[model samples]
Target: MNLKEQLMQDMKEAMKAKQSDRLGTIRQLRSAIKNKEIEARQELDDNGILGVISTAVKQRREAAQMYSDNGRPELAAKEDAELAVLQQYLPAQLSEAEVRDIVAAVIAETGATSMKDMGKVMPQVMAKTKGSADGKIVNQLVRELLAG
Candidate 1:
């Protein structure tokens, strides 16, 4: 089933089961997807839904860090829970070695010789690695490859 349909089904299940937390998280995701659709004036496909999920996960990560710094473990835990829920929709993440290999291939394809070519290399690398690899690790790999 598509993301929106799956979400609606899950929402119904959550309601029946009285899962307030899960229901709230799913509702928030739905709201995010709807807002994006309204803004763009187009319905979101699976890729767009994935983008929305990634953004929600990122926001929760940031909020979790802030909550932890403030000694609010309860709030931090909630954010972690939301992040976990969002991650359920994401594809399996790439391993570090896999990401490195992909970056190397992109660099070679782009004929990127030095750090100066990072801009040229990065777009291709990121397009290949998006949602699969961590951005920081990809950037570090690109930097190493360029420097070497």
Candidate 2:
């Protein structure tokens, strides 16, 4: 089954198990997906759904960091929980080492010997990593690789 089908099944299981936290997170995700569909006037495939989920995850991570920084552990914990739930649907994340390796390969492939070649290297690295790697990390790796 596809990601949406898997989400529906998980939502049902969450309901059956009386896992309110999990159920609520799933409902919120579904609502976000529905909103995107309405806004776009098209059904999203797995990749599009992933983009939405990825956005949600990024938001949660940022919110959690802000809350933690502002001395709000309880709220930070809640955001962290939601982030964990959202990440369940994302593809496994690549380690920094793995991302660095990909950046290195792209740099080599594109002959990016200097920062000016960054424009040439980043898109290729991001394309190869897709949503599996965080863009910020990839970017940092690219810059580091190019600068040194």
Candidate 3:
């Protein structure tokens, strides 16, 4: 099944199982997807929906960290739960070592000799990694590889 279909099925399951947290997270995702569809004036494909899920995941991670740093464990736990729910829809994440290897390969492929080549290197790395890699991690790897 497609991602939207999968999400709908999962939502129904969550409801049936009486998982309030899971249900709420799914509803929020569905609402976000609907808003994006309205804004774009068309149905979002799997890629588009994945993009939305990625954004939600990023937001939740940031919120969780912020809450934790501010000494609000309860709020942080909520964000962590939401993050876990959002992550269920994402591709398996690349490990730091894997991302570093990719960055190295792209640098070699592009003949990127210095930090000045970051503009050329980053986009290609990001394109290759896509949903499997986190942007921040990819960026750090690129900078580390290019600089050294």
Candidate 4:
């Protein structure tokens, strides 16, 4: 099934199992997807849906970090839980080694000898990895590879 269909099925299962937290997270995700669709004035394909989910995951990670830093473990835990739920919808993440390999290939392909070539390299790397790898990690790896 597609991501949206999978999400709908999971939502129904959550409701039947009386999983309130899971249900709430799924509903929130659906709402966000709907909002994005409205904003774009078109139906989102899997890639677009992945973008929305990725943004939500990033927001939750930031919120969790902020809550933890501010001495709010309970809030942090809630955010973490939601993050875990959201992550279930994402494609399996690329390992650091896999990301590094892709970054290396991009750097080589782009002839990116210095950090100045970051702009040239980033898009290619991001395109190759699709939504499987985190952008920040890919950027960091590219920087490290190019700087040295």
Best by TM-score: 4
Give a tens-digit lDDT track for model 1, residues 26-111: 99999999999999899999988988887888799999999999999999999999888888887788998998899889988988
Model 1: runs farther than 4 Å from truth? none
TM-score of each: 0.91, 0.93, 0.95, 0.96
Summarize candidate 3's per-residue lDDT along 30-143 as a digit string, tens digits: 999999999999999999999899889889989999999999999999999999998989999999999998999999999999999999999999888877888889988898
Better of 1 and 3 by lDDT: 3
lDDT of each: 0.89, 0.93, 0.93, 0.94
Least accurate 10 contiguous residues by lDDT in model 4: 127-136
Index of the highest-lDDT prediction: 4
Measured over all alpha carbons after superposition, the RMSD of each candidate to the real structure, in angstroms, is 1.5, 1.3, 1.1, 0.9
Q: Which digits, one per residue and each the tens of the lDDT, describe model 4 over residues 34-126?
A: 999999999999999999999999899999999999999999999999999999988899999999999998888888899999999999998
Q: Where's the lowest-lDDT run of ten residues in candidate 3?
A: 126-135
Q: TM-score order of candidates, best first?
A: 4, 3, 2, 1
Tens digits of lDDT, candidate 2, 1-148: 9989999999999999999999999999999999999999999999989988988998999999999999999999999999999999999999999999999999988888999999999999988887799888899999999999
Write the number of the candidate with greater TM-score, choosing between 1 and 3: 3
